[model samples]
Target chain A: MNILAYIIQKEFIQIIRNKAILPMMTVLPIVQLIVLSNAASNEVKNVNVVVVDMDQSESSRTLNHKIIANDRITLVATSFNTNEAHFYLQENTSDIVIEIPPDFENDYINGKQPKIQLLVNATNGQQAIVGSGYLKAIVASFNAKLIQKVIPDISISKQSNTTISSRYWYNPELKYTHFMAPGILAQLTALLTIILSAMNVVREREVGTIEQINVTPLKKWQFILGKLIPFLCIGLVLFTVGIIASKLIFSIPILGNLPLLFGYTTLNIIAVLGLGLLISNFADTQQQAIFVAFFFIIIFVLMSGLFTPIDSMPKWAQQLTVGNPLAHFISVSRKVLMKGSGFWNIRFEFLYTFILAFIFNGLAVWSYKKQV
Target chain B: MNTPIAIELDKLTKRFGDFIAVDAITFKVKKGEIFGFLGANGAGKTTAIKMLIGLSKPTEGMGKVAGFNVDTEPEKIKKNIGYMSQKFSLYDDLTVVENIQFYGGIYGLSREKIKEKTTEILEELELTEVSKSLVISLPLGWKQRLAFAISMVHDPEIVFLDEPTGGVDPRVRRQFWETIYQVAEKGRTVFVTTHYMDEAEYCDRVSIMVAGKIEALDTPHNLKQQFEATSMDEVFLKLAR
Candidate 1:
C-alpha cells in the first residue's frame, strides 16, 4: 500500500511483460555463467614439445622422456637437427623446442654448469609462460637425479640445494572452473544489476512516463528506489542461481560462511545498483543508458580480475581496480568461496566496497532533480 | 457565490542564459473552468505550463497552484494537481486496469478505492470490456481518453493536459474535449495546451501566447468579436500573423 511499493510493483509488471528483458535477465545469465566460466579459463594444457636431442646421451634421453611423460606436455618429434626443431616451432607444429647440446651429459658429469636451450613460441602468452615453466621443472628434476648418482664418492655441499616443495592450498589440483565460477558469478550479478538499474528510469524517460511521474507527488527516493529495488532483487536472484550452479554443476567449494557471502553479495548488488542509477541520471534515453553501461561494463569486467589475475596487472591498473566494484566483488567472492576467508580476512574489501556504495548512491540520489 | 482561483501566476518568467522562454506571463484560472493555452511552436506555452504544474521554477515570479506556492511549496503543490502529457504517458506493457491501479496506489489510494476508481473510469470511458488489455493494443483515441481519466485518478483539484488530443481525428478530438468538459462539470480545473485552433473555442477562456508573452486572453466569442473574425481559427491566425 506504500507509494514505493506501487512503483516497485509497476516495475515488476513491466519487467515481466517485456519480451526482450525477461530473456536477458533469466536465460542470459544462465548461459553466460555456463559458457563464460568454461571459455574464460586461464589454464594452459597439452603444450606440444619437439625434443632436439643432439647429445644422443642417457641424460638427454632421460630428460626428453620425463618432459613428455605428463598429459600436459606431449612429445611431437625427436630430432638431432636444431634447424628442424626450429622449423617445427615456426610451422606451429610445436609450442616449445627443447634442444639438448652434445656435451649435455658430460658437462654435468665433469662438475660443470650444463645448459639446455628452450625455443618457446610466445604467441599465446599464457601457454608459453605456463608450458615453459613445466619444461624447466622437468629439466631441474633431471639435474637433481644426476647429482644423486654417487659420482666418485664426492660429498656435495647440500646447502646450495633448496628444493621448494610447494603445495597449492585452496584448489590443490588447480581446477580452472573452481577458480573461475565464483568470479563469473560476481561478474554476472554486477553486470545484470548495472544493466537493469541503468535502463529502468531511462526507459521511462524515453517513453515520456517520467514526465508524468515527475509531476506527481512521488518522492525522489521513491522514484529512485522504485527502479533500484526491482534490480536489486533480480541481482540477488541471479547471484543465488549462480551460487547454486557453481555448487551443483561445477562442484566449486563453499569454504566460507554462506550467510557472510550472501551479506557481502547483497552489499555488492546495492553498490552496482548505485552505479547504474548514476548512469540513468546522466542518460536521457534507454539506448544512451545501454551504451554508457556497455562502456563501463567492458572496463569493469576486464579490470575485475575475472579472466585475469589482479596481481599480474601493472601497478597503476591495480590501483585503479581499487575503485572498481566488480573487482571488489570478484575478489571477495573468490576469497570467500575458495579460500574460506572469514570476516577479518575480507574486512578491507568489505569496507572499501561499502565506501564505494555510499559515494555512488549518495551522488546518484543527489543528482536526481524532480523539479528540473 | 464565486469560485476560488485554482492557479495564479504573477510575472511568471523562465529564461535560459540570455534567452527568455516564458517572459513575465501573468494569469489566473478559476476552479472548475476549462482554460486553453494557445501558442505557435516555441511560443512559450509549454514553459508557462511547466511553471504552473511545478515541473519548472519561475525565473522571477510568484505562482500558487492548489493553494500552495510553486517554488517553496512544490511538494504540497505536486500532491494537489495531476498532469497528462502529449505523449499519452502510460505503460504500454501494463493492462488498462493495472495502469489505473498503479496511478491510484501512487496517489495513496487504498486498494478498494483503486478498484472502485478503476471500475468507474473504465465504465465512464466505455472501456470496461477491454480493461484487462495492454494499453499498447488500444486504439490511439482510446489511449488518449484513458490517459485523461488516469491523470484524474487521484481526484486532484486541477489536471494539466498537455496537448491531450494531438494527432487524433477531429471527431476523436471532439470526444476528448467532451471528457474535458465532464471533468470541468465535476468542478476540476482543466489547463490544456493545444496546436488545434478549433479546440480553443471549447475552452471557457483561452490565452494566446506570441513569442514569449500572452498577447490575448478571453472567451473565444469575445476574441472573435474583437478581431472581427468568424471563427476561433481566424482569430488565432490574425493574432499569429
Candidate 2:
C-alpha cells in the first residue's frame, strides 16, 4: 500500500512539475470542442438547388417559391433550357434541379398528374437522400393546392389526421456540441492518461530506472495499481473540465445525474488506464507503446457510436463495438445530458464499463513484471 | 552467525529457450560487501544480476536475496534492495526534488521523511541550487548521480547496479564510484555489473563470467596474480581468449 502510494505521488509530482504537459492537456480539449463542434453536426442545411421553369406560369412560380423558402434549400441558379440545367448539374454547381415542363399548366388543367422532373445528384449519397425529401415535400404541397382549386364546390375537409408533438427529450435543440463535448472529454482522458502511464513504465525501461524498481520489494500489482490510480484521477479532472466547457461554451443542458456521469467517467478512466498498462507491458520502447495506445484509441473512438447511431451499423460491426468502452460511455453521456436517463436506464452501460475496467486492470497486473 | 549473507545462490541457471544465459553457478556476497559482477558482452552478467534481483525466474536452481527465496518471495526481495540499470532510469520531465518525493513516497516514506531526505540528498550531492531543474536538462553525469541516489531512496539492504556508468565519462564514473563507496560505508551491499574491467578493482571481491560460467571469483589482486597478469583487463583477456 505504501509503495503504491509512493508510485502515485511520484506520477502526480511528475505531472505537476512538467510545464508543457499540463497546459497542453487542459487547453487542447477546449480548442477541439470549439473546432469540432462546428464540424460534427449531423444537420446539413442550405443545399444548393437550381430551378428550370419552362412553363414560366403562376403555378410554376409558386412551386419554385415554396422550394426556395424552405431553410434546407438555397437557390443557386435559374435556367429555362434543359441543356443549361444539365450544365449546372454536370459542373457540380447544383445539388438538385426542379424542372417545370412546358405542358405543366396543361397537365394541371386537364386533371392529370403534373410531369415536373427533379434531377438530383446522387454522388453524395446522404445529400441526395435529404434533397429528395425536400423536393417531394414541395411537390406534395403543390399537388394539394391544385386539388383545392379544382374541386372548390365539393364539400371536403382538409386537415391533418394526426399531429406528432415531438419533444427532443434530452437536448431539445439537438445541438451537436452538447452530444459531442462529453464524449470528447471521455476520449481525451482515455487518450492522455493511458499514454502517460504506459510511457511511465516504458521510460523506466529505456532509462534504466526499472532495474532499480525491479530489485526493490515492490509487487507487480502494487506498481500497476499505483500507476493506474493517478491516471484515473487525471481522467476525472479532464471530465470535469469538459463538462464546464459544454455548459459555458456549447450551452448544452445537463439533464442527467451529474454524480452518476462522474461515477461512470471514473470507471471508464480505469478501463482505459488498464489498457494503457497492458500496452506498456507489451511494448519495449516509448514509441512502440505510443503507437499501440493510439491504435486502440482510434478503434475505441470510431466504433463507440459517437458520430453515428450504433443501431444503424451492421450486426458484425455492432458486436465488435460492444467490446469498446467508449461506445457505452458515448451513449450513457448522451442519455444523461440529453434525456436525463436515470440509474436504471444507464445500468447496462455502467455494468460493461465496470467489468471492462476490472478485467483489463487485472490483466495488466498479471502481465506486469516487478523485475527485469 | 556472522551477519547472514546478503545474497546466496546454489546451482542458479537461466535459459532463454535452448540458449543458456547463465549456466549453473554458485556464489555468496556477505552483507555490506561491494561485489563486482564482471563479464564480456553476452557473458551472462545481466542474466545473473536479473536473477539476483528477482526479475527473472531461474530455469533451474535456488537462490536467496536478503534471506528471501527467489521463487515464492520475489516481492519480499524487491522490498529489500535498490536497483540502477544502464539506461536513464529517472523521469526526464520531473524535477530532482519531485522524483525523490515520488520515489520516497512509494517506498512508504512519510511526507516529512521525504522532505527531510530530499534536503539531505540534495545537500550531499551539492544539488540544492538546481533541485527544481528537470532531469533532462541536467548533464549526463548529474543525471547518473541522481539516478544512483534515487535508487537508494528506499534504503534497501542491497543495491543492484547493472552497467550504471555506461556512456558516462571516466570522471563521472569515478564520481559515481565515490557514491557507491559512500553507500558501502553505510553498510549497504553494492552488487554492481560493468563492462569496464577497471571498475573491478574497486570491488571488495570480483567475479569474471565467460561463456555463461564464472571463470574467476576473488579479490582483484589475487585474481591478477593467479592469471599472471598485473591488471583485471589482462586477466579477462587471458581467460576470455
Model 1, B116-168: lDDT tens digits are 99999999999999989999999999999999999989899999999888888
Candidate 1 chain A TM-score vs. reference chain A: 0.91
Model 1, which residues run further than 4 Å from truth? A76-93, A105-112, A147-152, A156-164, A314-316, B1-3
Which candidate has the highest TM-score of all?
A: 1
Q: Report the TM-score of chain B alone for all candidates.
A: 0.97, 0.97
Q: Model 2's DockQ?
A: 0.60
Chain B TM-score (model 1 vs. true structure): 0.97
Give the C-alpha interface root-mean-square deviation per candidate: 0.9, 2.5
TM-score of 2: 0.90
lDDT of 1: 0.89
DockQ of 1: 0.81
Q: Highest lDDT: which candidate?
A: 1
Off by over 4 Å in 2: A80-84, A159-169, B1-4, B109-139, B167-172, B175-188
lDDT of 1 at B66: 94
